[model samples]
Target: MQYSTKTKFFNKTLSVFMTVLSPVILLTSVQAKEQIPLSETRCLQKSGYQPAHKFSPEIREVTIGNQLFDSIFSLGVKNFSEYKAYIVCRIPVNKQSHNTEFRVKFGIKDDANYETAKKTKVTFFLDGQAVESQILQIGQIATQNLEVSKNNNISIEVTCTQKLYTLDYCPAVEFVEASFF
Candidate 1:
């Protein structure tokens, strides 16, 4: 059977378009599943101190009194190909308060928002190891950065000195953002 010129041209163009589109679609699908092991992982632990929460209502908040004030947020990170999680927080001290002493911890969650073995490499900069097996505190609000991986729940435990009676004491924590590139 003989075909019209217009029909032949249309079929040729459609075939060409499909050929190009198929590869692009396939490539995209393959790329999406490609998992590259992160080499230079600053803090790409499978899990942090707690299972990462999916959502955090208050991205940032300040706690009052000398107590363990915490805000939980879960990052729905099933698995990562590359990149690390960091809890970059800022602590502020009230003028009258003695350099506030506090310890910040991050971990992965179990059934509840509890700590698990799949925690990230714990790095403490503010305090030292003496009081608790995994606890440290420095009486100061020195801007600090803590690293974690996988799913992590973060909290800051503080103990303000009584001397700072006139000063307002609180731990200011802020989850800046995450990067996988």
Candidate 2:
């Protein structure tokens, strides 16, 4: 069989386009099935103590977080060792699920305010909507599983109170684990 010159050129262009499109489609599928690590995403903005990657005193960093948690990276509020801190983490749609659960566990790993132990409250928000809030004490850890379906400009905000009892005893707020699966 013989083809016209126009038909021949059209066939070649379509072939090249398909080749380019194949990799992109495959990559997207692979990434969608994977877990999204909140710690790795880190904090986008914070009510400044430092960068929100400051792990608490009890946290030890390794390729994977130590004996207790499976952290992809060490993530805590402000590396400044603040007694009180607020941090925000955002996940671009490419990194989030259109429908899935955000699972997390954290607490006031700070020993700084052990003496006064004033009322400590932690609130979590998903896209500016309060999903969970808890009144916690030092050494208390809280866990949450939030159902998220947002596919655009998604974000997680962590707000807490960590009144310092002593000048030198400031501990950063820490999250042992946070992931979307």
Candidate 3:
């Protein structure tokens, strides 16, 4: 049998092309099999919070001046008593071995009357455990970092306990951002 020079060159080229393309196709198929949800930040409205007082316990999307924000978790409590607000969010996990990290940033809205602002106590919880607690005051921003293992629900409870006071005021805790990665 006699093979032409062009046929020999074509056979070699085909062999090289198959060798290079095999791994690329295999890699693509493997990646497609494992579909991981992208990490993202969701608003409190989407995450689910109990509704209260028209605006209380609602995710308030507001534009202040030129700044735009939609992550504010507001809880309006008016009185000198104990008030608790729970903001629960479920993190998506495809497998039991997957670990997710959550970052919760929040602050107390400043009030003209400093005494009214300092009368609130806020506590943060992960799952069902008390992770962090603080006496929320004006000009204070707090962050809670939690590492969640396996697939489970993440519940954030913001309990605002107001002390006995004379003036009438409604205190609220504004969540700046809640990010999961």
Q: What's the distance in Å from true for residue 136, model 3? A: 2.0
Query: Candidate 2's error at 178, in angstroms?
Result: 0.6
Candidate 3 all-Cα RMSD: 7.3
Worst 10 residues of 1 by lDDT: 33-42
What is the lDDT, from 0 to 100, of the residue 121 in candidate 3?
A: 57
The candidate with the higher lDDT, 1 or 2, is 2
lDDT of 2 by residue, 1-181 (tens): 9999999999999999999999998987776545776655545544445554543223453221223443232223322234345555665344344536677776554343544333355566776666677665555567778776562323444333554434433233456677766
Task: Please write out the lDDT profile of model 1 over residues 45-102, one tens digit for every residue.
Answer: 2222454433323433323222233333322221121222333222332233322343
Model 2 TM-score relative to the real fold: 0.51
**On a 0 to 1 TM-score scale, where does candidate 1 land against the true structure?**
0.25
lDDT of each: 0.31, 0.53, 0.55
Give a tens-digit lDDT track for model 3, residues 81-114: 5445655556756354344676666666543245
Q: What is the Cα-based lDDT of residue 67 in candidate 1?
A: 25
lDDT winner among the candidates? 3
lDDT for residue 8 in candidate 1, whole number 0-100? 100
Clashing pairs in model 3, backbone N/Cα/C closer than 3 A:
none
